[model samples]
Target: MSKAVKCLILLAVIALFFVTELIPLAITAMGGAIACGLLGLIPAKQVFSGLSNSTVVLFAGMFVVGGAMFYTGLAQFIGNKVVSAVGTGENSLMFGLMTVGTVLSAFLSNTGTAACLLPVCLGICASAKIPASRQLMPLAFACGWGGIITMVGTPPNIIAAGALSNVGLPSFGF
Candidate 1:
């Protein structure tokens, strides 16, 4: 096929993947980037730009900072403080976890927020006699939405921030 045809085919295929929700969005995007390079739709450097970009560095730094927060017991302390303030009942427990996930995801990694809350979530589930499977998905969804509340919550947001900045827009602070 021609280059334009390849581009169209690629776009259609990727769009279909997204519309079907068959894989994670980021994974689909990465696959598209790789295919672009392999099919000569873009230069190799462009395909690999995601790795070397400053936004990627920012994301890595955020993840490291998140690890530091956990290692220093900051997340646990925050969780405990919230639980203490709210007083633990089943409703309050879930609300507290969701609240923490939302607040932290505004400034930290979504995955990191999930990681930080995993043990605590399990404890809540066990204590409340709630199924881990039932509650985990809601927490995950909350974290994902929370991550969008700020630019640094996830890599895609960072990437979007960077792209907008490149076009002379204002920087999005975490």
Candidate 2:
């Protein structure tokens, strides 16, 4: 079989595995990359090169930092203050969650912001008797929208800046 066909088949299997919850998504991703390498669809070196990229390093650092905030109870403390300030009304709670998520995502990785705030949002939901489903979507949407406010807020912004620089245009600052 052609290498492309083999790669496609491997991807399909990976998707099936992901849908079936047969293995962790991380493992499935790594295994799919390995399979592509073994099938000669992508070089092994190229597949592994992503691990050393600065973007990957930044993502890992942000994830650790977010986790540290939670571990140190800083997240809880900040969340409690925000919740108390906003009161227990459903609209107030939703506004508080979106505002916090947006502000954090503007300065940090969106995923990292979401990770840091997920527990906080859940706690507020539990305490206020608000449905988690109602608040989580607004939080996520706010994060996405807020990431567009700064050049470093999302990967696509960085990629666009890099592309501009490659063409001798001024890169985005801050």
The lDDT leader among the candidates is 2
Tens digits of lDDT, candidate 2, 38-117: 78898878878778766677667767777787889988997898788998788898898899888878877786788678
RMSD of each candidate relative to the true structure: 5.4, 2.9
What is the Å distance of residue 72 in model 2 from its true position?
1.1
| Residues 24-48, model 1: lDDT tens digits | 9989989999999999999988998
Candidate 2: clashing pairs of residues: none
State in Å the error of residue 102, model 1: 0.2
Residue 28's lDDT within candidate 2 is 91
Judge candidate 1 against the unseen true structure and give its global Cα lDDT, from 0 to 1: 0.82
Candidate 2 TM-score to native:
0.77
- Our model 1 lands, by Cα RMSD against the true structure, at 5.4
Candidate 1 similarity to native, TM-score:
0.64
